[model samples]
Target: MSDTLIEAGKRTIELEAQAVKALGERIDGEFAKACEMILNCQHRVIVTGMGKSGHIGGKIAATLASTGTPAFFVHPGEASHGDLGMITQDDVVIAISNSGSSAEVITLLPLLKRMGNPLISMTGQNQSPLAKAAHAHLDISIEQEACPLNLAPTCSTTATLAMGDALAVALLEARGFTAKDFAFSHPGGALGRKLLLKVEDIMHSGNELPRVEKTALISEALMEMTAKGFGMTTVMDGQELLGVFTDGDLRRSLDQGIDFNTATMIDVMTAKPLTISQNRLAAEALGLMDAKKITALVVEDDQQQPVGLLHMHDLLKAGLV
Candidate 1:
């Protein structure tokens, strides 16, 4: 019984893979025209479908909306019951139906036509009424279903989803949609944090910064490190950043029999410590720390003065990691 299930799952995956692969060869002038229509749309792209097609349409609309195009999904069944008002003359409609004849989806065609909204149809059958009526028809037809009975909507839906992704990515490139633009739409997500959270936003500044004078004893530097709990402290000369004395430097000092009470921070400090710009992304600061195997970096200004200090914990707490 287990063997049967495994073989059936493998066969299903193979069929779905073939269906998606076939979409590459099927991309032609119709696909280009569909892309052009959506691009030229003055307002939103309204996506609608029934059943499984509806579920796929929702995801497609979300992808389009998040990738520079403004789009939303509407249930085809609800269109006749006042939801049709959600669509406007300036919008373009994308209707999805495996057979291109879902009654609920097809019934809205006349009204959409009257509203002068452009129609883009995705269907498994080329000769279907929905396809015939569309300004541009996308053929999501698959040779067979992944279901053993060849009656389910498996391979066809997979093909439709791949086509939707292809459309979205092509449009993304055409519009020069950038990562920064995507981050604006998803500010609550990790990608947004990585892109928008800067070192200045998370770095410890002003009184929270751990620092000491170049003339301060190692004991004083250690006292500052303990007070701030950063396992490190910056050595400053006036407003200029001189060096850094970390726990690692302390250990080396102890190993060399140096006296913390008498030795100055300049005697034990690492000259020209790694520093990051305040305007840099916190994620980049995290990368620099990881690459250098350090726990913190001094945030520096244009004059090489220490403005702030960033710790690994800051990036983690900010969700940039």
Candidate 2:
């Protein structure tokens, strides 16, 4: 029984893979035309479909929206029931139906046309009403379904999904969509934290920043480090950043038989330490920390003065690690 199931799964994968490959090869000037229409659209893209195509359409709309193109899924059935009002003249419509003859989706054609909206259609038959009516047609036709009985919508759906991804990616590149732009659209997730979070957003500043004067005793620097809980402290001179002292520096001083009580911060501090700009991405600061084998960095301003401190724990708490 297990052997039979495995064979069925493999067969389905092979057939669907072939269908998707064919779909990729079929991408041509028409695909470019569809991309151009969406790119030039001044407003949102309205994706509509029925049944299985509806599920794929919703995902496609989300992908487009998150990738810099504004889009939303509108059910074809709902659209005919006054939901058609959701679409406007400025919006572009993408109606999806594998057979190109879903009554619910087809019913919206005249209404969309009357609204003067540019219609893009995804269908199996180029001569189908929906295809002929579209300003640009995306052919998602498949040679056969992966279904053993050849009745299910497996291969066709896969092709439609791939085509949607292709359209979104093409528009993304044309619009010069960046990771930061994607992050703004997905600001609540871990990906957003990594891409949108900056050093200044979470860095320790003002009273939270650990600082000690260069002439202060090493024990005083240690006190500041302990108070800040960063295991490090910045050593400053009169109105100037002098250096930094870390737990590692304390360890080395102890090994050299230097008393923290007698040794001054200027004697034990590391001079010319690495500093980071506050506006830099947190992920970049993490990279620098990893490369330097350090746990923290002093945030500096353009005028070359220490303004804050950033610790690795802040990144961990922010879900950036």
Candidate 3:
């Protein structure tokens, strides 16, 4: 039974793989025209379909929106009931139906035609009514279904989804859509945090900053670092930054027989220490710390004044490392 199940799984995957490969080879002038129509659309692309194709359409729409092309899915069943209003004159419609004759999707054709919306169709049969009516038709036709019965929507739906992804990626390249642009669309996701979370957003600022006077005793800087739990402290003269004192510096000072009770920050601090701009991404600060083999950084402003402190713990807590 185990062997039988494994063989079935492999056969199903093999059939689907061949179906997708065939779909890839079928890309031609029609695909180019479909891409051009979508690129020229002044507004969003409205994707619609029934059943399994509808599920695929929703994902395709989401992928397009995230990748820079604005798009959304509409249920063909709801279009006749008032959802047709969601499509605007400048919008493009992508209708998906493996058989190319989904009744509910076909019913929206006359309405979309009246609204002057361009139509792109994904169908298994090129000669079907929906395909014939489309401004550009994508042939998602497959040799056979992955289902043993050859009666299910498996291979055809997979082909349609692959074609949708191809179209979205092509449009993404054409638009020169950038990583920064994608970050804005997914600010709450991990990629957004990596690309958008800045030093100021995660740094300990204001009263939480570890600071001591340039003339302060080494013991006093140690106390400040301990109180702030940042493993380091800034040595400042009014609004000007003189240098930074860290646990490493303390170790080196003690090795040199320096007295913490009398040695001031001027004698024990590391001057001209590495600092980061508060406006820069925390990822940059993380990189700097990793490259320097250090654990903390002083967050500075445009005036080069220390405004905050960032530690490796901050990056760990922010899920950037």
Q: Choose 2 or 3, whichever is better by TM-score.
A: 3
Q: Candidate 2 on 1-321: residue-level lDDT in tens?
A: 999999999999999999889987768998899999998899999999999999999999999999999999999998888898888999999999988899999888888888899999999999999999999999998889999899988998999999999999999999999988998999889889889999999999999989899889986887788888999888888768888999899899999999766889989999989999999999999999999999999998778788999999998898888
Best by lDDT: 1
Task: Please name the candidate that would achieve the greatest TM-score relative to the true structure.
Answer: 3
* Backbone clash numbers for all candidates listed: 0, 0, 0
Order by lDDT, highest first: 1, 3, 2
Runs in model 1 with CA error above 4 Å? 188-191
Give the Cα error of residue 6 in candidate 1, in Å. 2.5
Q: What TM-score would each prediction reach against the true structure?
A: 0.91, 0.93, 0.95
* Inter-residue clash pairs, candidate 3: none
Q: Candidate 3's error at 77, in angstroms?
A: 1.0
What tens-digit string does per-residue lDDT give for candidate 3 at 7-97? 9999999999999999877789999999999999999999999999999999999999999989999999998899988889899999999
Candidate lDDT values, in order: 0.93, 0.91, 0.92
Q: How would you order the candidates by TM-score, starting with the best?
A: 3, 2, 1
Scored by Cα lDDT, where does model 3 land?
0.92
Instruction: Please give the lDDT score at residue 183 for candidate 3.
Output: 97
Quote the RMSD, in angstroms, for model 3. Answer: 1.5
- Candidate 3 at residue 160, lDDT? 86
Residue pairs clashing, model 2? none
In candidate 3, how many clashes are counted?
Answer: 0
